[model samples]
Target: MNMMGSLVALLVALIWKPDFEEWRLGWDIKLFARIFSGIVISGMAFAVIVWCVDANGPVFVSMFRPVRLVVVVIVASLILQEPIYSGSIIGTVILVGGLYLVLWAKKKEMKSMSNPVETNRTDRNVV
Candidate 1:
């Protein structure tokens, strides 16, 4: 389904531009290497995400999005020499904080589930 969506987008782009050069990949080794690396990395990431969703559920897997964003920002800044704006830093901090909150909540919920409290009741009709 994802591949189908990508194919549809590619078709639309081709139709809208109708220029073969825009759709063509020339014989550039750097371009080829980048495309290859991107495809391999994205494919492996997608596979891992699917496995995580199956094993830990969607909420657990969804946390990876912010982690991925943070990683990308770090990598782009360090490796690609990209500039990091103040907004990016603030957003990253917020994302990390939210992730921590979710994780803490999950831990607390799991703890509660494992050790449910028992109530001693004196009156059955008490509300």
Candidate 2:
């Protein structure tokens, strides 16, 4: 899936930007460092997400998707000194609330499935 998406993106980029000079890379350490680290980080993140989905199912992994936004916001604010706006705080609050509800519901469902309720029924015989 990842390879297919990457190939499609490369094809689109090639078509959109037909100038080969635009794709030229200079002998710069920073450019190479950024490209290499991005590839490594993306690969590691993909592997971890795949493993998590396999182990805990998609629902469990999906809940963290929004949480990643919150994490990115916080990390950027701290590391990059980016400003945190009121909207970000409000959105984070909403995301956390929704995540809590989902987790609670999932736990309740698992608990019910583990201890299923017994059902009673009566049968009538023909006279």
> Where does candidate 1 stray beyond 4 Å?
1-18, 25-43, 121-127
- Against the true structure, candidate 2 reaches a TM-score of 0.68
**Per-residue lDDT of candidate 2, residues 18-78 (tens digit):** 8999888788997888798889988998899899989877888889889989999999999
**Model 2: ten consecutive residues of lowest lDDT:** 118-127
Candidate 1, 35: how far from true, in Å? 9.0
Model 1 lDDT vs. the true structure?
0.88
- TM-scores of all predicted structures: 0.68, 0.68
What is the number of backbone collisions in each predicted candidate, taken in the order shown? 0, 0
lDDT of 1 by residue, 2-113 (tens): 7999899888998899987777677899788978877998899889989998987788888867788899999999999999999899999999999999989988988899
Could you list the CA RMSD of all candidates, in the order they appear?
5.4, 5.2
